[model samples]
Target: MVELAGEILNLPIPPHDEVLPYSESCTDKSVHDLNADNVVLCRAGDDNQLGIILEIQREKDKRKRFSWPA
Candidate 1:
């Protein structure tokens, strides 16, 4: 796992009309601050969702090799 400090990064989803209660272990700010093993936790409807970045794909795009929690 790699971390990027003081840089802009994107999450899996774009901003939405109604965003549920969500927590990303690695936030845009966290990425900018350079945190590792990023995980996002959120609620939608009646479900719990997570977006996890297992690895970084590219430094150029800061492309994240990520997955959803099960």
Candidate 2:
């Protein structure tokens, strides 16, 4: 997964020991639920290396621009 992300996004992601699924919910003080489609956690031993959030948008939604940043 790390290699694939680096290749596809041209990211300089470091090597990780494990890849695991994470919580999709974002902590926000809002009434609406701000949840991503999926979240991934890259770990290098006991340290957390990176977090990747995957959101699949089938149609154009301007609201995503604001929500994604949160």
Candidate 3:
């Protein structure tokens, strides 16, 4: 996975000790809840290394521009 991401991003991604499925929800008390299609958590040892969020959009949605950043 890291190899694929590094190739696509053109940036070196360090090796992670573990990769796990994460919650799809992103919620803030001051803002509306945002849900993604999938979320991945990358960990190195006991610390969190990176978080990957995946949102699958089959059709164009103008609202995605605003919601994606949240």
Candidate 4:
């Protein structure tokens, strides 16, 4: 997020420690062990903080790609 905050958004990165929940899931019960940079943003020790999902994807070369993600 330091990269995102500083490079992309040009904003200050929060000093608070980040908590990356292991296998954070929603209604679909999906997993990210093999896919996605599906991030949930939140400050530490705040259970009431509803995180927003930030899905980061890299563009694939269309010439070599066979399938696309949904």
The number of the candidate with the highest TM-score is 2
Tens digits of lDDT, candidate 1, 26-68: 4453355344444343445555543334434456442233432
Query: What are the runs in model 4 whose C-alpha is more than 4 Å off?
Result: 22-36, 47-53, 57-70
lDDT of 4 by residue, 4-64 (tens): 5456756564544564654434433355343334554656566423343445546666743
- TM-score of decoy 3: 0.74
lDDT tens digits by residue: candidate 3, 1-70: 5556668779666678988999998788788888888888888999888787777779888987777876
Q: Give per-model TM-scores.
A: 0.22, 0.76, 0.74, 0.33
TM-score of 4: 0.33
Q: List, residue by residue over 1-70, the lDDT tens digit for candidate 2.
A: 5577678889888678899999998667866677888889999999999888877789898987676777
**Segments of candidate 2 deviating more than 4 angstroms:** none
Q: Which candidate number would show the highest lDDT if scored against the true structure?
A: 2
Clash count for candidate 3 is: 0
lDDT of 4: 0.47
- Ten-residue region with minimum lDDT total, candidate 4: 27-36
lDDT for 42 in candidate 2 is 94
